[model samples]
Target chain A: MDPSQVEIPPLKDLTIENITENVHLINSRCPNPRLKYLMKSLVKHVHDFARETRLSTDEWMAAIQFLTQVGQICTDVRQEFILLSDVIGLSLLVDSIDHPKPASSTEGTVLGPFHTHDAMTESNGGTLSHDPDGEPCLVICTVKDTSGKPIPGAKIDIWETDSKGFYDVQYAGRQEPDGRAVMQSDDEGNFWFNAIVPVPYPIPHDGPIGKLLKLLKRHPYRPSHMHFMFDKPGYDHLITALYLRGDPYETSDAVFGVKESLIVDLKTVTPKQAKEYGVAEGCRLLTYDFVLVSDEEARSLREKEAMTAMEKLGLRMKLLDGLPVPDVD
Target chain B: MDPSQVEIPPLKDLTIENITENVHLINSRCPNPRLKYLMKSLVKHVHDFARETRLSTDEWMAAIQFLTQVGQICTDVRQEFILLSDVIGLSLLVDSIDHPKPASSTEGTVLGPFHTHDAMTESNGGTLSHDPDGEPCLVICTVKDTSGKPIPGAKIDIWETDSKGFYDVQYAGRQEPDGRAVMQSDDEGNFWFNAIVPVPYPIPHDGPIGKLLKLLKRHPYRPSHMHFMFDKPGYDHLITALYLRGDPYETSDAVFGVKESLIVDLKTVTPKQAKEYGVAEGCRLLTYDFVLVSDEEARSLREKEAMTAMEKLGLRMKLLDGLPVPDVD
Candidate 1:
């Protein structure tokens, strides 16, 4: 079909069909095929959403103002857009799609905004907390291949909130990292650390996202969980969090990061049992195993999934010289 | 069904169905019924868009960064978020939906970023341009209601870029408004002004929006047009523009503001005819009529359309005390 032969609809008669067609025509000039496809889909959905909701001019202006405020309040220390995504569940949906792990491998969750490099490296079985007023807890976990074989020299990075549910970064006067540590697994792929039991806490809501939560009448609490990142040579990195079972927000984590496999039971120990771990009596212990996938397998799976997605969108590349260029760089 | 009896899907098994369900549950507590309904629909469309596009994590991060940059660049002098909305065809969509005029009424277009509140008040036939390099042009128009009765004393506010495609605001060293004036219609609803013809120019592309245009391989040009706003006490205000026919970007306006009825002929006048309009010999002339709508009729139509929309969205209010509260505030 000739482009010039197309009948352009008048703006006054601006139906949904006209908006979609006009958007597609303007975006056709996009040199990047992937970007073009995304733009078309974004326009279609945005226009349809407006039509479906019969959004008034006031509502649209309100949205413009809300988005602007979200952007204005964002800084190096805070990301309101990411928080918005988290609350709407878009971040988790993207994560799940990007990291479609095999059944045997550990599942990934949101990479919360609190992560920082330069966590102090601790020896095996060292305590990670310095708070004297908090209840002591011990975590014993193993890192291994999908087949359950021990993987030596694996790096286990761990971080969690204190008993009062505040990450060290959340404190305005903090100068040093607390409740965060990195340790290498023993020869048997085992590592243990002592820390305070994390309590449920609301995400910071003093900004626009918080105001939005208030308007939406939604609570802002995330389930208590310990963040972890496990890595080794020739294996895909695992960025995940382990949630404590029976936490008040476990079923409705504000960030939507809770998974059945990631939720673990916290076993309470008596005074004698606590001494064995060199902590006070009645401390809690958590044990779990993380299964990692090989790098080669992970890459292959991602490529396959991407190809299937492109095909579904009718965006398969045109063949040149009996081969097709990948839509993704 | 009881709320507690609802099954909560694990985040790891977060299908599209699960995300939709979670969003509805989280937003259930919104006090405002209309806002609650709108939130549910917004969440549904946003999630569907992400899923349909099979959006990658990198793409999501890129979007967040883009929005942040647009916001950070905004100031008292510039509005980057509004520019983004314009480029995506959203600003036009909102305007078209909000201002559904009668068949006999004039159409409305974009109120671009260059509008200023301080246009000088000029006599009905006074010249508006101070630029010596521009070709003098004559504009004779009339304002009336849909019943075809002249609206005496109606204020017609007009502004446009000079022939060089620069609004007075676009110049950094200017202290006075040029090529803009406010003229009231005579007893016969007739008004005329002397100004320079507008020229097509690119929308400002020196910011993130500019970078986006380059990435998309799309030009940033708007069709040459004259802006006008008509206001009267008992009629709905009309904000609109008249595009010159044969401009290169008329069919592909960057801001999506062009309409069939808005495109007008720019007749080049002979030396003898120019003497009649009291302009230079080779100046151009444009004549058009704008029909306004009664405020009462416009409000009635808006209320009816809004009700139909709410009914379509299944958002009707439950009756209490033999009366139902309207969905709109």
Candidate 2:
């Protein structure tokens, strides 16, 4: 590259007051408008955060080391960074912002770190977990649009911990997948399955994130919950969870995943209801209806949100010339 | 622990607008005042950044993955996190804010990852490197206070790239150290040594930060320079580097380490000067002085900066409530 053609700001000797301007000027050369905007905002916030903290060298170095540890402890099945983000409330914030919905549609929550693509595929009324220790549960759920029309063949994936508050994947040398599986709704937009009532359990907190929780004097337990994800062609995909009612950790969930609309109650199965569902003598029951929005509606809502944010910033800013124009705060 | 004993807000089912508030409320329980402030500011900036950019789930996940890779790639020999911080300009910002100086005091810069405490100690006029392929240069430098009183017995640590634009530690299977060393000044506040004239080089790319630089269309080169550190009891420690005058990359250092006052010139030594310094024919000469501030003065400046920052925030906020009150952007 020619020295004369270099696009970053001609900032040679950066001082404390000028470093931020230099960074912004250099980023002004980015060709992609969206990326340029993201980078610019990121730098401004980070710089402001440091200055506001008056962060010392020792403290700053400690943060660098902490991030390094969070990265180093990650493995194929475990994600320490995601757990960190969840504990810090970032995952939930992003989820809520990205997946806005109407009052009638089901709300979305965090897709906790236990999700995996290898769950066994099953059909309605089939068993999801076969642990002898867990009490049986019968799930009766349906898929529909905002207007209540049945939408058949919706894919539903569910995963949760066993009665012991431990997912099968967390066990040492685990032989097979348990307490988690995938199934599709029937042609009548109804699906039912046999599983256990999941209890509240602690997140994986033996890593740097765990250390951080201890430092903050906060516990590391998430509320009792059963994870669910729904997907169908021409409809928005929903990643949400159902928190069992009366759980002690419900209100102060470490990840803040619980919602008033998502908290659900379970009932003792009657004899007739048990026979109809082909469940064992002692079983609990859960009934729910998931409402989804059309693809066009979801896209329109996203655009509306972006426009609102832009108006809040009071910018009629045109991004077509390539470099983003968001001023440093 | 009893459910009623939890100190965080009794917030359940958080919404987009409420999530930030919930985070701040929960963090209000921290016992350490300083940590509470830092975490509060950090979350605000991060959340504000996400909202301002309308960050999508896909982009957020991509960032998580990028940070994970950065951590995974690190080992005893590499520090990718520090490199990341340096390139994004946070390291320099923190350094400058933490170490503000008057006009007469020397400025500090990024302490790049090449620094290690193992450099061999040498005396004045001794050789720092034994590379047979590079031209030799003699350094004549002194340490003093802002009042121009020479400070004797000051410690100086110097490190630089060889003529090949590589530090001694950059090689594979290398035996002895080269191009870096540590020593002290004599009673007269002067120290001199022989070493190669370092050239410009690129930072460690080929990782996430490198990929980011490429995406931003930014180069990875820093200008030719030698690193210097001065230390003494009751005086502020200085970590800085000296840029060679007229280097092509001078104006666009990748790490943003170059400053006009920190850049210096080198020229051919006169025969008498060469004889006095006991240097071989054709060796170049570099002469400079480093000024430091006392610990008391440094503390006062830091307090002033923090007060100014507080004023900018319009906060006469008291931190004794065991909670920090920095507002979310």
Candidate 3:
């Protein structure tokens, strides 16, 4: 302990462990125990990642720049960084571990980067596709409980792309919500609608996330599909999409939303059956059944839905209660 | 399974559960298993947090806004968000769990948000405080092994504030790296320098971190302290700071960098002792000793330092071997 025995300090020997240890010391001195623990844990992991990788200065700066671009790309309509999470699979992993669904229900998928709050409601069997130039098609679906009983008065919120593979929102000027509709089923748990067969398309690629994917040598296409969110009381809510069979990107969906159970056959209908469904002869007709799980599964689904919504919107705890709800449009 | 028993789709009952479950299903279809797992997990946590708090649309947007601001505020020199992490203690927590330093050497603390690479090197007994306008004092320190033997030829990198409590970096024009020095210990593990004692001061408050603290109703002051990073061949590197005794903000240091063992007293020197050390009579002197652990500890310290340097410089693995080191200003 003699003052004469003090050694001078060295600079180059700086390491992650020392940096983190210093950070921990600060954490231990914080006034709030919870904040302290939280900060300490975060610093430790971040530093560890840096140390394990032997991260270089340029790489660190690049990361900082990537983060900066992620912020800049965020706007009211586009959340490319969140989409980055979708592509990276961080979002889905969180969803699965937190929302363990029952075996009887359909699996959930990502709420892709492009979900808006404004779709016009329509009567049962109403057409979501307003464009006459698109290929004519009919969609018939059955809603039932896990035990095979029909669920009366179920609702189907549906959306799809035009034949050109563009959503109404994507071509705001050209389309008037052409492929978006909300319809309620009748007493027989059946729902039918007329629409155009959606085509496969590429996600917007002008942003940083797109650039990153390109850098990674990945494609940016999603298979043709119809988005659906089905709901009935006492049954698990289902947010799902039906992908068309034989789509090229089925296996390499840019956002990774494809499932074997979700692929459906679009059958060429006869003129007689077409007349009955109010569609022209040779039009494609697609039919599928959506089975809802029990009450417990339904609850989990609800929890998962809430979590997904929050994450997409990037809602933090402090702003949860008093912030105004964003306009769905 | 009869077609006649199928129920129609319903619209009104589409609860949050359906939305979440649907999202989960799509997530499971990702091509890369790792990406799928990560996305699911992130989505689940985000959604759960949202649902648990009932976050509204506005609240969500506000969060997005906050994150955006966090990104916007980051730059080459100022990293307010990182400071936020430091204050919140995430950085430290991560450090501790990653590098469990043995209890022999000085415990680590946070590397304050502001540090420059170009510190002036000084010979033995060289004073860092060129403008000695504050509490005039002599700093005497020693480095020793666990057995209390001197560690010969150790290096000590030291930095602190002037009597007015301002680092050289804080005032661009006024200081020439004053109050910062790199020196080597003699054969006896002893190092001494004459300087002015630093006073407590406020961290910069013009940036986003300052704005956030203000929003949270918190102060922005750190206790007076001298920074030290000591290293020897056979022992662990020591990254530490010495807090001034009786500082008003010791308990509430903005970045929480106070440690009980690191605090030291500034004693007034007698006329006789001042002459012996060839200093002015009635000057003040602060003395402390640094003890280093074995080689393992030193290796950990070195690792942490390298990691931090890499993080600061933004280096990556691909560039490490052939990359040229940046010129330190």
Residue-pair clashes per candidate, as listed? Answer: 0, 1, 115
Alpha-carbon runs more than 4 Å astray in model 1: A1-15, A117-136, A152-157, A162-164, A168-187, A231-234, A268-284, A296-329, B1-14, B116-138, B152-157, B162-194, B231-234, B267-284, B299-329
Residue-wise C-alpha lDDT for candidate 1, range B88-177, written one tens digit per residue = 888777676666678888988877777778889999779888888877788889988999999899988899887788888877777888
- Model 1: pairs clashing at backbone N, Cα or C within 3 Å: none
Over the stretch A1-74, how does candidate 3's per-residue lDDT look in tens digits? Answer: 11123221211123333655654553454444334433444455555444444433335445556767776666
lDDT of 2 by residue, B1-329 (tens): 33356666687878777788798888778877778888888888888887777777888899999999999988765788999889889889888887888888988899987887788899998888788887789989988888988888888999988888888777878677778889898887899999888788888787888888877878888899999988888888899988899998888998889889999998878899889999976898888898888887887787777677777877765422222244445
By TM-score, who's the top model here? Answer: 2
Docking class of 1: acceptable
- Name the DockQ score for candidate 3: 0.07
Q: In terms of lDDT, which candidate is strongest?
A: 2
| Tens digit per residue, CA lDDT, model 3, B1-329 | 11123221211112344535444554454444333433444455455444444443334445546667766665544665557655554444333333335556566666665655667778766777877477777888888876789888887888887767677776755435677888888899888887778788777677766765554445677778888887677765566788888887766666656767778888877788687778888888889888877776544554555456556657532222322222234
What TM-score do all the candidates reach, one by one?
0.83, 0.94, 0.56
Q: How displaced is residue B52 in candidate 2, in Å?
A: 0.8
i-RMS values of the candidates, in order? 5.8, 2.7, 13.0
Tell me, by DockQ, which candidate is best: 2
lDDT (Cα, tens digit) per residue for candidate 1, span A1-329: 12243344333334434776777776776767767777888888888777666666678878878888888987765678889998888888777766668889999888776777768999877988887776788888898888889888988889888878888887887788888998999899889898877788888788888888778767788888999988898988777999888887787777888889998999987687677777666678888898888887776675566566557767755422212233454
lDDT digits (tens) for residues A1-329 of candidate 2 = 33346656677767666788788788778887778878888988988888777778878899989999999998877888899889878898888777878889999999878888889998988888888898788988998999999989988999989988888888878888889989998888898899888788889878899888877888888888889999899988889998889988878899989889998998878899889988876688888888988777777786677667777878554322222245444
- lDDT value for model 3: 0.63
